[model samples]
Target: MSKLMIDSFRGFRSFELRCPGHVVLSGVPRAGRSDVISALARVLLPESRTSPTMSDLWQTTITAAATGDTEPGKDEESSDGQPPAAAQRLSSVEPRPYANVEVTLTDLDPELEQLFEGFLERCGPDGCAVAEDQALPGAPWCVRLAYRLVYDSDVEALEQFVYYPLASNPTAGKYTRVPASTRRVLPVVMLSAGRPLQLRAGSPLRRVIDELDPAAAAAAFDVLRSRVTHAAEELAGHDAVAQAVGVALASGGVGACLTDTPLDTAQVGFRADDGSAEALLKSLQPTVNLDAAGPLALASHGSTAAAMLGVAEAIMLATAPGAVILADDFGDQVDTANAEHLAARLRASAGQLWLSTRRPEVARAFDPEELVRLTRHGGERTWHRLKRPADRGRIRAMRQLHTQLLPALTSPAVAITEGPHDLVVYGTVDRQRLPGAAPLSAAGVRLVAAGTGQDGGIGEIPVVADLARSLGFRVIALIDRDKAEEQTIKQIEASCDVVVRLPSRTAIEGAVLAGVDIAKVRAASATLTAFLSQDPADGVPDVKVVEVVKRSLHKKSLHEPFLDALVEETKTPPPMIVDVLNHVAAAASPSYSGPAVIDIPPIPLPSAASPS
Candidate 1:
C-alpha cells in the first residue's frame, strides 16, 4: 500500500517540499506541525542529537530522583516475568542517535561558504567541535547546519556551537578546528503562537543571570524570585531602550526588579505547563490585548519580543547560505499587516520554507503558485497544489454558466420532459454545466403532467407555453416529432429553445437510458410494415432502390403495417392531428432541412404504449 506520512516525522520515508515553494500546512491543532518541524530540526542538527530528545534541559534534581534508587546489579523487579535490570541496562547503554535529515550547507546556500570558513577557522585546533570528525582521511570538513526554538532562548542558541565539529582528530586526542573550507550549512526554525501572548521572551532569568557572579550563575537561576512590576520605568533613563524593554515586560509572566526588588507578573511566564518543546510550539496561543487598543497596542508588553524573534529567523536565513526555515505560526491574530511583513521577509530569506496557514488571503500576500493547501481524505491528510489558469475567458464562461445559467434554470423554473429519462438526463446535464454545479434532482423540477390525451405525447409546444404560464418559470422542453406531431411543435416554439429534435423518434425513456441519439432512430412500425410484403419464410433482401428521374423504382418488401395504421388513424384523430400531418415528415426521407415533423397524413391518435 502506498501511503503518505502526514501526522508524524517518524513516519515519513523521504521528505521533499516542492521547489521555489512555500508550503501552507492548514490542519486542525494536534495535526502534527511540530512533528514535521522537529524532524527537520533533527536532520539539520544531528550532532547534538539525544535520546528522549531535549534531555539536556532536564534538571539534575529530576534526573536523580528518577534513577537514584535503582541498583546497578539488581534484577529484582520484573515486567512480564522479565527482570527490571534488563530494561534499565537497555536504557542505560548509550545508543548512538542520528539526525532526521542529513542536510548539507551546499543544498541551501552557496554564498555562505565564506561565513562557514571563517567560523571553522575560529574553532582552533583543540578539536572542541561537538561531534566526532570522521570522514575519508583528508576531505573538505563540513559542519551540520540545523537549529530550532519554540521561543528565543540562550540555550537554544548555543546548540549552534555544538552542531559542527569544533575541534578534530578524536582518535589522536588532537581536537582542533578543521579549516573553514569544509563546513555544512543548517536550517533555522522559530515557532510562533497560535492564540495569544504565550512566548516568554524577556524573562527575569536572563537579567538575573547577567547580574550574578561567574560562580553564582547556577545559584542565581535556582534562587531567582518571580515578581510582577509595572513596565513604565524600563524606559525612564533611556527613552528608546525603556520603551522596548517595558513593552517586552508587559507580555506577561516576567519577574522584574522593581526599585531593586524583583516582581513576578502572573500574566506571563515561561510555560509552566507540562509538555515537550514540540508540544509547546504546537499549542502556543497568540497574545490578546484587554485594552481596547488595536492588536499592536494590546501586544505592547511582548510585542517587541515576538517581533524581534521573527526578525531573527529572517536574519538567520538571510545571513546563512542554503538554509531552510519552517515557521509554524509566525504572525499574531489581530495584526495581519505584520504577518504580511513577515512573509515579505521570508521571500528575501536565504532558503525555501514550508508555511502552514488557515488564511486564504495569504496567497495574495505571496506568489500565487507558492501556496499549497493541506486537505484531508478519509483519515489521512494530503496536499493540493493550486495552479494558476492561463485563460481568463474560460474562467469567466464557467463562472457565468454556474452562477447565472444554472440558477435561472433551477430556481422558480418548470422542467418538462417528454418522458421520465428526459427529466433525469436534463437535470444531470444541467448540473455539469454550472459553476459549483450541483446535480438536478427530480424533486427540483415540476414535471407538468400531460393528461390522458390520445397519442399521450405533447409535442414541444404545449409543454413549453403551459409551463411558462402555470409555473411562472423559465421552461425547457424536449419534443418528439412522431409521424404527425408538427402542430404540437409549433405551439412549443414560443417558450422552448427547442435545441434539437430527434430525427429517428423513439420513446424518450429509451433515448435517455440507452444513451441513443434521436437524429437517427430506426422506425419500428415502418420497418415492420415494409417486411410484411415479403414471405415470412424468406429473409429480407439487402438492396437500395433509387427512382432516378422519377421513373418506376421500388424498395423491396414495402412496409405494410405503417401504411395500414396511418390509413386507419386518419379517419379518427384528435384536434392536434390537423396541425401534425401538414407540417411533419418521415425521418428516413433525405433533405431534412426543416425541424422534425409528423407528416404522416392524418394519423388518428392511438393508445399510448408504455416505454419498452
Candidate 2:
C-alpha cells in the first residue's frame, strides 16, 4: 500500500497517509487509529460490514438543509426514472458532500502488473498520466482504488460502491465498479481485537474450500448434505418424534391432521441445515482433538494466534500478490515476548501488513522507520512517519530505539541523559518532586540515556534528538558539566531545545555528592556495603568511605542501591541537582496545541518523486 487518502470520511475531514508496507501505528486512545483500519476495510474488503449509515455521512449541516428551501433545481432528477424526493418536501434538501476513501497500491509483482495492465498509470512530480499522454513518463506506475458514498436526492438515502477510480482527481471518472470476481485478487483480511484465529466458519478452511474447483466442491457437498438431511428425516419419521410433535401442536378437540388436502397427516418435520452447496462450504467448521482432551478450542490464546498465523502463511499470501491483512490493536491479547514473535511472523505472512497498538513492545518489534505516530487534536487527525533514510531496520546501531528510548514515540518531551546512571538519579528526583502525581511517565515525559560516552552512547544524543523531534517531541539534553567534549556539546545544542549542565566539573557523582555531611555519607556507604554482604569494619577512614561511594557511581550494577540509600539519608537534595530535573520535567503541558509534525511529507518512492 503506497498511500491512503480520505475526505469527508468518518472523523477525517481530509487526510493523506503514505507509508511503506508493514507499518506499526502507535497513539493515545481514541486517536482515530481504528477509523483508519475501518477505512481500509471498507475499500478493500467486501466481507467487512462497514456499510455506510446515516452517521457515516459527515458533511450535512442543519443550516444547509434549512436554507436549501430554494434549491429544487432540474438536477434533482431521480437516480432511476422516478420522481425526486425534493418534488414533495415543502423545502428542498441539500445534497450531502461525497465521502471518498482512496487507496493507491504500488510495488506490484510481475503477475499483478499484468493483471491490472489497463488500470496502471505513471504517477510523478507532474501528476499521474498514461504513457500515451507522455506527461508522466519515467515515473513509477500504480493503481488507485476507492470507496465513494454519495447521498442520492431521488432515493433519499446514501449509496456507496468500491471502484477503480482511474483519474488524476479520482472523484471525477466513470463509475466503474470493482466486481466481486476481480476483488478475489485483492483480498483483505481483518484481524482486530477479541478476534483470534479460529477453526470455525470464515476461517482458513473456508478460504481453502473456495479455492478448490467450485463445481467439484458443490457436487460433493450435494451428496453429503442429502445424506445428512435424509438421516434427519428418518429420525423425525420415527414413531416417538412424530407423536410428540403431533400432541404438541394438536388442540384437545381436533384430530392430528394438519393439512386439509392430506388425510390424517402432519406437515411438520425436522429441517437440516439448508443452503446452496457453495454456501454450505462457508458454514463448515473444522475441529481439532488431541489425546483425551477434547477441543473446546485451541489450548491457549498463544497457540490459537500462532496456529492462525501459520495457516495464513500456509495459504501463501505472497502468491496472491496484493493480499492485505490489517491487525487492529495488534497483539492486545498476547504476552510481550510472544507478541514480538508474532509481530515478526505477521510481517512475513502478507504482501502488506498494517498494525496498530498501544503496547510499546509490539511497536518495537518493527524497525523505527516502519513506526508511524498518529495524533488527534481539536477533532483533527494527523500521521507522522520517520524521515531517516530507508535502512529498513538493518542497522542495529539504533538499539536504544528498540528498548529504553521506545517510549519517546508517545512522550511529548524527552530528557536525553549522558549515561545510564543519570537516568536512575534523574528519574528518582522527578518521582520525589511529584509526590502528589505519577512520575515523569504519567506526565508523558521520557528520560532516555544517550550512552556512557562509549560505544556511540553520548554521541547518539543528536540522532535521538532528531528522531524525537521528527515525531513532534521536545528535547532536553542533560550532560555532565565537565566530561563532555566541546564539539559533542555543541551538536546536542543544535538538535535539542534545552541543554542542562551540572555545576561540578566532574560527572554526576561529584555534582550529587557536593555539600553533604561526612557522617551522612558514611551511613549511606554502610547501606551499600551491607547490601553487598561485606563485613563492616569499625570506623573505616572518612577518605576511604568517599572512595567507596565514588567507585559505586562508576559501576552501573551498584548505582541503584547506593543512590537509593543516599537519597534517603540526605534529607535535602542539592539545589543545582534539582534545577536539572526541573528543566527536563518542564515539557509536560496538560493541554497541548500540537506541533506541526504533520508537515513532514512521506518518504518518496525510490527514484520516483511524489505525485502532485
Candidate 3:
C-alpha cells in the first residue's frame, strides 16, 4: 500500500490523495477527477511511459516574484516573507516549466523495502541543476522536496530523478529509467472512462493481464474464456437467452465461438453466420446472440454486464494483495444494485481501490469518510476528505433526501439553518426584497434545514456545516445566538466558512421583530396591542414580540402574510438578512473582495409615547 502526493502535476497545483484503502473520488465534471487517477498511475508505473488523454503538455512554469532584500548569506524575503529562497529565486528567474510526480511508500514489507532501496541507489541526483546558493540552511531532511519525473523538452525525453531527503545533501538525482523490478512490486490497474467493454484482443482486460503476468497470459485468457463459455452454455438452457440462440440457429445460422487472431488468446463469445463451413473458423469478429434475428457484440447485451465482466477479470488478475485498482466513473453503466455489489467485491478483493464517479447512487455505496471531493478554483485544485465517525444513521437519512439536497453539493455556497421554519423565514425574506435574486437557489446558494440535535436541542448547524465543508462547498451556518452554546457556536464558526448569528440574541424571528417598525406590526396584525400589553412600556422583551408574531402567523404558514408584512413594513432589510445576501453575492462572484458591513441602526420599539 502507498499514498500518492502530487504537486503541480497536470491540472493539480498541490493535493495529497491517500490510497491507504478503498477510496471513491467524486466531483462535478471537468473538476480534475480523471486527472488525479492518471497522475497516480503515472507515478506508480513511471517506466510504462503512459500519458493522460489530454496531451496539452502537463507542465507548470515557475517564476520568482520580486522580494525584499535580506542579509547576503541569508535567504531572500518575499513580500509575504514566507516562501523559501529557492522558491523565491525560481519565481524571480525566467519561468522554468516542468511536471512532478511523487509516491510515498507505506506499510512496505521487507521485500518491497529492498526493491525501493535498489531503485533509490540506481537513481541518484546526477543531472539535476543544484541550487546550492538558494538552498535553506539547516532544513530538516524529511521536509525537503523530492522529484520523480522532470520533462526536458529540449532533449524530448522524460528525465527520471530521485531525491533522497534523508541524505546530508538534498538534490534531485537523475537515472536512466525506473527499475522494472521496482515497478513489479507495485501493480496498478486503471479502468479509464473511455475503456471499451467489448472483449477484443486489445481490450482493457487483456492489457491488465499482460502487464501483470505475461507468462500466464495464455492461461489467464483460457480461464476467462471458459467462464464465458460456461455462462453462455448455462444461459442456452434458460428462458430468454435459450430462445434467442435457438431461433438464430434454426434460421440457417451457424454457432461459432468468438476467437482472437492468435489462437492462443481466445475468449468466450458467440458468432452467427450463414450455414457456410468456411465462415466458422475464418470469422474475423465474434458477436454474441442477444436477439432471435442475428448476433451482436457482447456489449450489445448492455454496458452493465460487459463492464461487470471486465472489472471481474481485472480484479481476478490483480492477484497481488497490495495491488491497486483505479476505476474512473466506476458504476456509471450499472444499476444501483449491481453498482453496490461491484463496490463490495472491489473492497473485499484489493488492498487499495480508487474509484471516481458523479452518480449519487455510486457515491452512497461506500462510507462517507472514504469519499474524497476534488474541487477546482481558478488554476488550482484541492482535495477534501470527509471527517470520520460520520453518523451512518444521519447518512441514511440524507440518502433519502439525496435528490432534494443534491444541488447543495454543487452549489457555490450553502447555508445550513436550525430547522425548516428558519429556512422558510430567511428564504422568504430574501426572496421578497430581492425579487429574481433568490439566494437559496437562483444565486447558487443552497439553504439546508438540519433538524434538531440528538439530545432534542435546536443546534444541528455544526454537524451540517461539517458535512458541507467535507463535500467542498463554501458553508455558512445560520444559528440562533440564544439556542446555541458559546462553545458550540465557536466550533461551527471555525468549521464553516461563515457563521451569521441573528442580531436579537435569539432566533431569526426575534431579529425580524426587533428590526421591523412597531407601526408596521400594528398595521399587519390588528391584535398586536394585546401581546405587547403584558410587557413594560420602556422596553419590550424579544420573547414577548416573538410570541406575538408566532401566534399571528400560526394560522397561515410563516412564509405567507406575516413575512409579506415584515418585508413591506420594514424600511430596510434586517441585519441577518443583509449579511446572508452579502455572503451569497460574494460566493456567486468569481473574485470575492471581502465581507461588506451594513450598518443599519436597530429600529426603536415603541416606548411610553407609543401609538396605543
- The sequence of per-residue lDDT tens digits that candidate 1 reaches over residues 151-246 is 124443222122333433333434343222333233444444422233332222222233345466544333322111122222243556555555
Candidate 1 whole-model C-alpha lDDT, 0 to 1 = 0.37
- What's model 3's overall lDDT? 0.57
lDDT of 3 by residue, 1-612 (tens): 335666656666567655556788876556777877766666555443544222423544566554544556764555676765454454322212455555554444556656555333221122222344543563211112244555555766654444434352323443344544556456666665443433445455546656778878767556655665576566555666656655564454333333333221122234335423223323333466755946776656777767777677667756775767878777878887788787778777777788887666666667766777777666566677765554675574444234334435445567777776677777777766665444556656777776532322345566666666667777666766655677877677777776665544465555556545555554555433344443221244433544565454533344445656555666455555666566555644446555432222344443322544
Kindly report the root-mean-square deviation of model 1 from the true structure over all alpha carbons. Answer: 24.3
Q: Candidate 1: worst 10 consecutive residues by lDDT?
A: 544-553
In Å, residue 282's CA in model 1 sits off its true spot by 24
The per-candidate count of clashes, in order, stands at 62, 0, 8
Global lDDT of each model? 0.37, 0.64, 0.57
lDDT (Cα, tens digit) per residue for candidate 2, span 288-389: 465776764444334545544543543344345556778787666667776777777767767777888777878867767788877655456667776555
Top candidate on TM-score is 2
Choose the strongest candidate by lDDT: 2
For residue 449, what is the lDDT in candidate 2? 80
